[model samples]
Target chain A: MKEDPFAIKVENVSKKFSRNLRRSLFLGTLDLAKSFVNLPPDTTKLRKSEFWSLRNVSFEVKKGEIFGIIGENGSGKSTLLRLIAGIFPPDDGRIVVNGNVGSLIAVGAGFHPHMTGRENIFLNGTILGMSRSEIKAKFDDIVKFADIGDFLDAPVSTYSSGMKVRLGFSIAIHRVPEVLLVDEVLAVGDISFKRKCMERMEDIRKKTSIIFISHDMRQVERICNRVMVIDKGKELYTGETLNAIDFYYKHTIAKEVQNIDPKLIVYESTGDIYNITLNITNEKGENTEIFKHKEKIVFEFNFESRSEYQNPILGLDIVSPEGITITSLKNVIFGHQRPSIKVGHNNFRVILEDNSLMPGTYRIAFKWRKQDNFSLVSATGGRFAIQSEPELVPFGGYFKVKYKWIQN
Target chain B: MEYKTIYTPNQRFKVNIFKTWYIMFRNVYDYRELIFQLFKRDFLMTYKKSFLGIAWILITPLVGIVNWAFLNYTGVLDPGETTIPYPAYVLLSTSIWGLFMGFYVASSNTLNAGAGFIMQVKFPHEALLFKENFQHLVNFTISFVIIITTLMLFGVKFSFLSIFFPLTILPLFFLGSSIGLIVGVINIVAVDIGRVINKLMELLLYVTPVLFASNTENENLQIALKYNPLTYLLGVARDLLIEKNVQNLDIYLIISLVTFLIFLLALRLFYVSEDRVIEKMI
Candidate 1:
C-alpha cells in the first residue's frame, strides 16, 4: 500500500447548525429516527432556522506541516476543528484523518473534577487513546511537563484553571498522536507555560502534523506553514501565511458594516487602513527572522491605506515573548513631524544599531495613529524576530545597556 | 496505532450498522483498562465521602427486606405461606430482584452515568456500560452474601440445584439490561422515559410477587404475576435455591432465549443511535 503525502484530507466538508435549540434537537433526533427503517438523511437541504456553519470547506494538510485556520468569533473555526477531531460528522463530503487524532480542543475534557491530578493523567491519557502501559511509561514526563508539583494528589476540582490547562496539555502532548487538533488552548496558560507549549509544539512538529486554529495572527505566522481564512463559514483564502492573513484583513473586517444602534460603532476606525505587513533585514541586507547578538537590524513596515494623510504617526513597540513590553518608539508629535502617505501604498523604516537583545523570541507590535488627534486608528502587524544565542549568553537580559559604576 | 476514523453522513452512517455490529463485542479489547479505571474511579469516589461507606451495599437490601417482613408480621399485608420462613423468602426474592434491577439501572443509565466523559471526550461509549456493571457486581456480591446469611439464620437448607444460582440468574441480568439499554437511549431524548421507567420498575416489583408468595389470594395480583415474565424467572430461581420443586422450567428456558435475542436487538439499537444521542448530549 502506498502512503499518502497528506496527513489529513477534507473534501467538500460542510457542517450545519441551528439557531433554535428546541428545533435543533427535534430535527436532530428526527434524523436519528430516520436512520432506522432504512431512511437516508437529506444533508443537502436546510430546514427552519437551520443554516450551514461551514460550507464546502476543503483543504489538505501535508505530513509534518502545521496548518492554520483563522477566523473571527462565530466564524465556524471551532466547528471546523471539531469536525476534524471526529467529534461530529460533516453533513456532506468526507474527512480522512490518516492516524490516531489527539484533540486539544477542550483540554482536561475527560478529567473528573472529583479525581486527583495523578489519577486524571491515567484516566485522561487513556481517553486520549493511549494504552495503560503507555500512560505508565510517560507518567513522569507528564508530571514534569505540567510542573504542578505537590498538587498531584489534590482533586482536579481544587486546581486553578491554569493548573488544569497545564496538566491537561501535559497529558495530551505526551500522547503524541499522528495528527493533533489545537483550538485556542495555547491562549489559556501563563507566559512561561505558553512558551513551553510552543516549544513543545515546535519539537513535536517533526513527527506529528498539526492543525492550529487561533485568532492571533502572530501565533499563526510564527507557527503555521500554511493558513486558511474562514469568514462566516466560507473560505475566503487559503495559502501562504502572510497572504492568507493579508487576505483575511482585506475581506473579513466590517469596514463598511454599521451597527444597529447609531451610538455604537461596530469597530473603531483603523485610519483608512487596508492592512499592514512587516519584515526585518540584517546588515548583509538579507531578510531573516533569527539574528545573532549585537547585530545591526532594520524594521520595515509596509502599510496599505484606503486614503492617505499627511503627518501620519506610525509607532512601534518591541515586546518580549513573555508579553512584556520592553520598549516603545514613536515619531515627533510636537511639530507633527511624521511620514506622509499616499492613497495606495507606503513604507516606513526604524533602525536599531548594536542590538544587544538576549536569548529568547521577541515580537514587533505596530500601531498606526491619526494625523490630527493622534488617536489610534488601527493596530496591525507582527513581524520580525531578534533571536538570541542561548548557548553563548545563557544569562543575558532583555538588552545590554552601556553603563558602568563610577568608583562606587 | 493504525486507526483511521473517517466521518461521513447518510451512507457512511448506514455502513456503520454492519460495521458496528461486527466489532460490537470483539474490538473493545483495548478499552478494558479504561473500563477498569472508570470503575475504580466511581467505586473509590463513592466510598470516599461517606462514614458508613461500602456498608450501605449490605444495608440497603436488608432494610428493604425488613420493611416487607414487618408488614407481613403485622398482618396489615397478608402474603401467602412460603416454603421457607417469611423473612427468608422475602430476603431471597428481593435480593434476586435487586440483582436484576442492578443490570437494568446500570445499562439504562450508562450514557448519563458517564455524563462528564460523554459530554467531552470521544472514546468507546460501550466501555461505560462495562464500567457501570462493575460497580453493580460489587453491590450484588455483598447483597448475595447477606441473602445467604439471612437464609441460614432462618435454618433453611440449600438445594443441590443451588449450584446453578449464578447460571440460572444469567438470563435475568441480560433481560434487565436489554430493556434498560433501549430505554436509556430514549431517556436521552426525553427524560420522562427515565422517570416513567423508574415508576414502572416499582410497579413491576409488586406485580412480580417479589416479596409475597406467587399463589396469592388476590385474583388481580395473581393474574399480574402470571402474565409477568419476571414471575417465572424470579420465582423459579428462588425455588431452585432452596428445597425445590421448580415450576415453569421450560418457559424459563424459552424466556431466556427470547431475552438473549432482545439483548442483541437492543445492542443494535444502541450502536445505531449512540452517535446521534451523543450529538444531543450537551
Candidate 2:
C-alpha cells in the first residue's frame, strides 16, 4: 500500500524533564559534553528525579487540517508545539514537518519596548521568520490591521498591552505561514479584536494547516476537523471533536471518583432493609456520563426491599453545581402515591423526552420517604453533564429554553 | 504540499559538528534582518528616556580616566616605565579596556535580556548575542573619538598605525564574545555563574595592564600578567597605536589564531546546547 503524505507527522516522541532546575542544568551540561564526542544519551535509564513530560506520543496531521489539542495545564501540549516549531528538539522518536512552521505561542514575544510600534512590527516579523521584503510589502496592512493609527510611530513602551497584542497578532497572521501553531493567544485583546482575529483565523484556515491548543472547548468543537485529548502527558483520545470531548468528560469523572469515599455518599442507610443503585443512560441503552442538550435520557433506579410498605415515596431532584434545583421528578407530583410497594427487588425508570437543562454538570439527588413525611434514606443518586449544542448561544444564565415566536 | 519535520530527543551531548554548523549558519543567515533589528533595539533602548542619553556611553571610560588622573595628581598612583605620558597612557588603555569589557558583559547578558523571546520563538538565539556585542561597537566608536582628541591635545606622536588599531582589537572582540557566550549559556541555567563572571571581570581588570602599567619588580605579579591573555592583546593594540612596536607581532598573531579557534569551539557548543538549554529555561 502506498503511504499518503502528511503535513506534519510526529512519531513515537518522548521528552523527559526534571523538577529540580539546578540538577537538570547539571545533567544537561553533562549531556552536552557527551554529545560533543558523538555519544548517544542514556534514554533507557532514569536518573534521581527526572520524569517523562511526553512519552511515546505519536500523531499525524494532514495538510490544511485544523488539528485541535485540548488538555489541562502541564499536559505536554506546549511542549509538543515547541517541538514542532523547532524551538526545541524532542528527546526520542521523530517529528516531520515538510513546510516552514510558525508559532503564536506568546504574543509580543520579541517586541522591544523602546522601539516604535512600526519598528517592532519589522522586528517581530523578522523574529517570526518573515524576511525584510515580506514585512515591507505588508507594512501598511499590518499597521492598519493593528488599528494603532497615530501610535504606529510611538514607542511600544507607550502602547497599551492591547495595542501591543494587536500589533503582534497582525504581523503574525499577515506573514501567512504555511503551518501555524497557535497556543491560546486568542484569550488576549478585547471582544471586537477577538472577533476580528477569529474571522481572520477562519479565513487563514482555508490555506494553512493549523495546530490549535486551546482550553475553549466551544472553539474546538466549532473549528477543529479533529481533536486530540491529552492528560498528564498521555493521549486520552484522538478523533471526532465531539467524541473526544465525551471521552474527556468520562476521563475527568473517572479521575474525580478516585478520591470519593463511597461511605460518605450514604447519608442514612439501613443496609439490611433496603438496597438501591441508580444508573443513567442515553436512549440507546448504553451507559453515558454526558448527554447533549434536549436529548432523550433514561434514569433507571433499582431498589430491593426486604418488606412491604404502604405509600412509600421516592423523590428525585436534578440540582446544579451551586445546589439550585433546575428540575425534579417526584412520584407525588403526578398524584400517583403508590398504594403499596411489595417486597423483593423492584425497578423504577424515569424517562425525560427532552432534558432541557443548560450545559453544565448537574447532580441527581434521591430520597425515600415512609408514610407521609418520614425521610428514610437520602443520597446523591448520580451526576451527569449536558454538552452544549453548536447552534445555541453560550448562555451564562442557567436552563436553556425552547419557545416559539408568534406573528400577529 | 506535504512537508516533513523530524524532531528527536536531544541525544546526550550528541556532537554532529557539520550539522551544528549548518543549522547555526542557516538560521543566522535567514534571520539576519532580525539580528540587525535586535542590535537596533539594544542601541535605542540603551539611551531611551535617559537624561544623559548617548552621553552615558562616554561616562564609563571618562570616569575611569578621571579616577586615574586624580590618583596620579595626588601621587597616590605611581607610573613606572611608560612609553607615553601618564594621563594619555591611562586614557587610551582604559578606553580599549572599556570596549572589551562592554563586549564581554553585553554578550553574557544578551540572552538574559531576551529570555522571553528565546523561550517563545524558534529563531537563531545567537543573533541576540551578536546583537548585544555589536551594540558595544557604537560605544567603542564614541570612546575612540575621545581617545583621538586626547592624543592630539597631549602632543603625542600618534602614528598612522593608529588607524589600524581598531582592526587589531577584532581578535579581542572574538575572544571576549566567545568567553561571554559560554558563560552566558551557563548563566541561563545557573544564575550564580553570571555573578561569578562579574566578580572575575572586576578582579581581572586590576590584574590586566589596563589602568596601571605592569609592576615589573614584583616577579610573581609580572609573570601572572605576562600569561594573562588580555595583557598581551592590550599590549599589541597599544603598541600598534602609540608605540609602533612590531617586535612581538608574532605573539599577537598567534594569540589571534588561538582566540579564533576558541570562538569556533564556543559557537559549536552554543548551537548544540541552544535548543535543549533554552527549552529547559522556559
Using TM-score, give the best candidate's number.
Answer: 2
After superposition, the stretches of candidate 1 with alpha carbons farther than 4 Å from their true spots are A255-408, B1-3, B11-13, B16-19, B65-80
Q: In model 2, which runs have C-alpha deviations exceeding 4 angstroms?
A: A1-4, A33-40, A253-354, A362-408, B1-4, B11-19, B68-80
- Writing each residue's lDDT as its tens digit, candidate 2 over A144-212 gives 889999999998989988999999999988988778999999888999998898788889887788999
Residue-wise C-alpha lDDT for candidate 1, range A1-408, written one tens digit per residue: 777788899899888888887787777667767654446678778889899999999999999999999988889998888788877678888999988788888788668778999999998888778898899999999999999999999999899999999999999999888999999989899999988998999999998999999977668877999999898888888998877765664453222111111121213465576556566788776876656668888877675778767786667777775658787777756755577778888787777776877544566665567667565454533434444332333234577777877985
Comparing only chain B with the true structure, the TM-scores of all models are 0.89, 0.87
Question: Model 2 chain B — which ten-residue stretch has the worst lDDT?
Answer: B6-15
C-alpha lDDT of residue B253 in model 2? 88
* Per-residue error (Å), model 1, residue B93: 2.3
TM-score of 1: 0.77
